[model samples]
Target: MIQPDLVELVALRGAAHDIALHARKPVLARLQGAHRSAQRGRGLEFEEVRLYTPGDDARNIDWRVTARRGQAHTKLFREERERPVWIVADLHVGLYFGSRLQLKSALLLRAAAILAWVATMDGDRLGAVISDANNQVSIFPPRSREAGVLPVLEGLVQAQPKQPGEESFNNLNKLLTTLKPLLQPGSLVLVLSDFSALDDNSETLLANISLHNDIRLIGLVDPLEYTGLPDGSYRAGLPGRLWWLDGNRTRRLWQEKWAARKKYVDDMANRLNLPVIRLDTANPVTEALPQLLREPSWQI
Candidate 1:
């Protein structure tokens, strides 16, 4: 059953979505630098004249060039300032549990909210991929209009978590194969997942994705998940068949689980060459988001 508090988290993420900065690749991606280039369309300002080609448009012909060189000339151009931002969310059932105020699935909504706001704020484009058991892929090409962000949140609200039986047919590897091409050069890719090692294919897809865009991996984990609940007898099973088990006693058996999970997350981050942002399910993303967003993209 969905928790009431979790529903609130989703609503909060939807309400606050729209805090993003315009971004670009550093001018020196090849030489190594701490920033990406923010180049945009060529201004209409007059530039020096160049000889006109056979197919040159007469409208662009420089009268001064024609007069001085006795031949028509034209101006060159740069592309317009339009960047795209693509976001993928993971809501596998594994993320549905929380020992605290919220579950990992609910926390993802917060991250999505921050991303939606940022992507739409700077005249950028937006797209989304929901990596659930269904492996659904919804792509909304980048648009500058104000109406874009809502569709993204709507998609998240409607997304369903993957079930165990579903995983047998649709895994992350097959999912990423479809997702990779959706990203254009310079797009910002944000992945929100509990990131259990479900398949080797997911790793390969991530590696391939890194070749074209900047990727951020957000690890969503609950404190209780890492540290098992204190020993106590809790009813398990339906009605008359119910039985109680010692929760605290079982926790000691896997107390180091969080440490191991951290190592796995770190190892993946290292392989993908991306930064990992760890957040407790109980914590709100807004608390640390501004800092994360403001941090130089080049650093990650």
Candidate 2:
């Protein structure tokens, strides 16, 4: 993968392009904000209510109404009018190889940078988790300050793939377990992965999270990663191997098997209500940036 600084620069440029030209029409739905007015309790429209937990903001309390009702009524407004996005990036070793201009992981970093920039630019808090294992997770609690994006970028740049045996036995599930407590209603989660390691339990965890947060998938790939050499002929330095997969387990080179797995992943994303932003390892991220910035399927 390219260095983090390079990916960060590319992302900043892409985000600027989207913000300047795309405006409210960015291809990514999570960049868009949904309005939630302050609480007046006039009708049945959903109101945002945070339980009167310790350290709750006192200024938000509806004191006048509380005095009238003769009970403590902490005010709950509609959900925040600002956008808040959570990004989960996979640094698994599988994404480290690419047959194109950049590594698959590099492309993911660029995509994440764009997301981070857009969310922060829209005055929304941006939180991210760089998960390679249970112990290697880096979490930045949501915050709206523009400066809040730095930590996420830094984490991405600094991240390294988990060492052998250092990798989590259940990376996605472990990450989700940690994520559940931090998430609140109406959060947005963007997961960037090759979808190579997802299992049944991990899928369920993701589905559960989607009930409260908008979850989208950015599935990364390289042409050579899927379709083996054309004409079924072998050549030196053809490309990297898919060691973690089944067909490739026999130390054989084959693209057909990789294609089958890729198709399965695409189908799974569709079934999970996760929209995919496909990335070609050989192409410039700018080529795909415009499509990614387009309206999402749900928006359509």
TM-score of each model, paired residue for residue: 0.71, 0.71
The residue-level lDDT of candidate 2 at 82 comes to: 52
Kindly give the number of clashing pairs for every candidate.
14, 4
Off by over 4 Å in 1: 1-77, 160-171, 235-245, 296-300
lDDT value, candidate 2, whole model: 0.65
Each candidate's lDDT (Cα)? Answer: 0.64, 0.65
lDDT, candidate 1, 1-300, per-residue tens: 453333543355444443445444455652443223543212233545789999877888888768988877887654434456677777665665667766666677667766776666555667777765465566655665456667667666666452223233344455467678766666777777777753467767888787777778777878776777677777654345677768877676656776786787788788777877777876656776666665665232
Tens-digit lDDT track for model 2 on 1-300?
454574455447444454411234434454434333211111223475433556777877767767777665666654355545788888766666677688777787887887777677656678887875334677888877566677888787777442223334455566676787788666667788777777777778888887766777778888876665444334342135322334333234565578677777777777887776777877777667656666545231
Against the correct fold, how does model 2 do in TM-score? 0.71
Residue 187 CA displacement from its true place in model 1, Å: 1.4
